[model samples]
Target: MHRGREAPICTRMSHPLVFDRALLRARQARALALGPEPFLLERATEDLSERLLTVKRRFETAVDLGTPTDLLSRALAGHPGIGTLMRAAPLAAGLAASERTIVADEEALPFANGSLDLVVSALALQMVNDLPGAFAQVRRALKPDGLFLAALIGGGSLAELREAFAIAESETTGGVSPRVAPFADVRDMGGLLQRAGFALPVTDVDRVVVRYGSPFTLMNELRRMGAGNVLAERRRVPLRRATLLRAAEIYAERFSDADGRVRATFEIVWLSGWVPHESQQKPLRPGSAKMRLADALGTTEKPAGETP
Candidate 1:
C-alpha cells in the first residue's frame, strides 16, 4: 500500500492561470453575433453521439458541459438513451433557448456530488485555466459508474499556423509573441483521468485536416470559430501589418499543396471515463490467475538462465 498524505482533488491553487477566460467568453459572444462557424461543433457532436450509442446503458440525467453551441444538446435531444438533456455554458450568449440551459463555468461545475448520470463536453475544457480542478469537479458530480465524455482541441491542432506566426514575427520584428493557445497532449489525458479518480479511462485522438484557399481564409475561419488567441501573456500591441503579411508568405511557402491550398490541422482529443464502482471491471491482481502463461500456451516452462 502507498504511504504519506493523499493529494487534494482540486488543484486550482497549484496551476497558473493561462487564458483570459473573460476575453474568451467575449470573443465567443462576438463570434455568435457574427454568424459563428459550426463545423467543428457539428463534427464533435456527431462523434460524441456515435460513442454514446456504443454504451449499453441509458443516462437519465445528462449535461452538455460548456459547449459554446447547441449542437451537442440538439444532437442528444430525443435520443432513446437520454432522458433529460441540459446545457451549460460560461456565458449567456452561448446558451441555447432551452428551459434546462444554465450559465455555468467549466472550471467550477454547479452540480452536487453524485448528481449527474452523464456529463459530455465538446470543444470546451481546453480553454479552462484549471483543467485538473475542472476534471475533479466532474468526477465529484458523477454518481458511481456514471460516465464522462469530452472532446477538446489538443496539441498539433494549429502547428502550421503557430510555426508561421513564430517565424514571421521573429524575421520581421526580431521577437516572438504568444499568438496561439497551448493545448493538452493526448498522452497526459489518461493520467489526468486517473488522477481525478476515474475508472477505466480512455483517450484517443482524431486528426481533422481542413484545406483552405489561403492562410488568410484559415485565420478568418478561426476567428469565426471563436478560437483566436486569448493567452494571458499575449502581447498587448496589435500585430503589425508587415508581420501579418510575412506570416502569410511563410504559411503559403511551408504548408501549401500542389493545388496551392493550405492545410489546417485540428486534433480533437476524445476522453472517456467512469466513476469508480464495485460493478466496474478491474484488472486482475498479480499472482491471482488460475493458469500460468506456459500452461495457457501449452508450452514447456524453463527457468531463467537455464538452457535447453
Candidate 2:
C-alpha cells in the first residue's frame, strides 16, 4: 500500500485484465472502415528490434513483448542489428513462418523471473489496460541489472489534429465526439515505472511531423497503418460530410505549415530502465568516525562527561 494514497492496487497482473476492450474493438472497426492495413503497433515492434540490434551489440538474449508479424525474427535473419542473435522460435513455413510464440498478455510474461537480459516493447504498452501490472511483470522477467526499452505515443501527439477538430466542431455545431484518444504523459509514465519498482527510469521524446495533402488523406494513412484511436464506450455516429469538410478547412487553415501541407504530430516517448541489483552493496565499519573530543571545548581538553 502507498504511504498516503487510498487508490486501489494498480499493480496486479491477475486474470481478466482491465484493458478497455471497447477501445480495442473501436480501433479495429476504424481500421477496417478506413482500409486494409496492419496497426502501427506491428511497425513499432519492427523498429524496436532494429534499434536493439543496432546499438546494444553486447546483449545476445532479448525478448520482444507483444511482437506482431514476426518482425524481430525477420530482423534477426540478416545484419539483424549488431548482435546478430537468432530468435528462440524458428520460422516453420508460409509468410508468417518467422512468427514466434505468441504470449497471451504482457501483464504476465511466460519467462521465469530474472531470465531475460533485455526486454523491448514497441507501441503496444498504450493498449495495455493495466499498465502498472504490466510494468511489474516486465520487472519480474528481467535479470538482475537487466535492461528494458520501450516506445509509446505520448500525450503531445496529434495536438494539431485534436485542436483543429475541437475548434471546428464548436464553430459549426455544439461539440462532436473527440476522435483522438488520450495518451500517457512522460511524467505520468515515469511515475508508473517508479511505482512498479523499476530503477533508473528515463524518458525522451521523438516528435514526428507527417505532412498530408488533406485531412482525409491523413485519415487514409492512419487507416493503412492501423493507428486509429480506440476508446471504450465509443460514440458510434458516423462523421457527417459537413463535419469532415469543416475539419479539413480548420486543419488546412490552422495546422498548415509554411509549405502549405497539413502536419500531423506524433510524439513518441522512449524510455529505458534497469533492474535493481542486490549485489550493489557496501558494509559500514563500526566506529568509522573518531570523536575529536579535545577540539569540542576549543581548549584541547575533554568535557567533564567524556569517558575517553
Candidate 3:
C-alpha cells in the first residue's frame, strides 16, 4: 500500500506538503463563473469553472470539481460544443435563452461511486493538501475504464521568479525567502495516479514562455491570473524596495532576452489515466502455449508430466 505523509489539513487526510492558501484563494477568485466578488479568489474560481464546462461537455457524463460561476454556467448553456445549435450565433442566442446548472467543490464530489464517465480538472489539484486522498476519491468516483484528465502547474513552473528571488535574497540577506511553494514533479504526479489505483497513468509536460517588460509586470499578471505563490508560511509583508530592485536586477541578469523583456517559464503538466475494471481483467488459460522448462536451459525437453 502506498502510504503518503500526513499533511496538516484538518480533515480526513492531510497532504504531505502544506497547501498554499494564496494559491487556493487565487484559484477561487478566477472567472470560472461570471460576476465580481469583492474577493479576487472567488472570481478566479468562477472563471475556472466556466472554462471547465468547455471540457465537461466532451464526456458522456462529466463532473467538475470546484466552485462554479453563474457567468460560466450561463456561458456553458450557450456553448456550441454541447451541440445545442448549428451556428455560433444561434448557439449564443440559445445559450442566452437557457438556464444552466453548475456544481462546485472537489473534495466532496456530488456523485455516486463509479458513476462518472470522465472527469477533467484544470489547474486545481495541487491546491488540495491531501492529493493522494483526493486521487483515491476520484478513482472511486469513476466508472470502470473511465478517464481522468487534469492540467496543473508543476515544479518547473515559474523558474525565473524562483531564480530571481533566490539570487536577490542570497545577495541582500544571505538567506532564501520562502515566498512560494514548489509544485509537484512530473514523475511524482504519475506515481500518485498509479498509487491511487489508476491504470495506465501518464504525465506529459507543456512549456509556456511568457514575456514581461519587468518582473513586477510579470508578478502582476500572475496575480491577475490567480497563479501567485501560496505556500503556507509565505511572507506576509511586501518585499522591501531595495530587495525588489535587487530581485529585478537578478532576473534581468539571468533570464532577460535580447529583446529586453524577461521570460517566465511555466511547466504545465498534463496527467491522464483510467479506472481499473474487472471486465477488462485477463486470466491465464489452461493448455496455453508455454515455454518448455528444460529446452531453454540446453537440457533435453521434458515429456508431459516428466522432470527434465
By TM-score, is 2 or 3 better? Answer: 2
Among these predictions, the greatest TM-score belongs to 1
Candidate whose lDDT is highest: 1
lDDT, candidate 1, at 15 = 80
Give the Cα lDDT of each candidate.
Answer: 0.89, 0.64, 0.61
State TM-scores per candidate: 0.94, 0.70, 0.68
True-structure RMSD, every candidate:
5.0, 9.5, 9.8
* Cα lDDT over the full model 1: 0.89
Which ranges of candidate 2 are over 4 A from the true structure?
1-19, 22-60, 76-99, 278-308
Q: In model 1, how large is the Cα lDDT of residue 173? A: 93
lDDT per residue (tens digit) for residues 132-209 in model 2:
777887887677877788888888988988887777777777876667767778888788888877887888777778
Ranking by lDDT: 1, 2, 3
| lDDT of predicted model 3 | 0.61
Model 3 residue 304 lDDT score: 89
**CA error at residue 128 for candidate 1, angstroms:** 0.6
Put down candidate 3 lDDT per residue, 27-135, tens digits, no spaces. Answer: 5465223223323223433444454455433444554344222332333343443332111111211123332223334555445576566665655666667778878
Rank ordering of all candidates by TM-score, starting from the highest: 1, 2, 3
- Candidate 2: minimum summed lDDT over ten consecutive residues — where? 86-95
Where does candidate 1 stray beyond 4 Å? 1-12
For candidate 1, report its TM-score.
Answer: 0.94
* Clashing residue pair totals per candidate (backbone < 3 A): 0, 3, 28
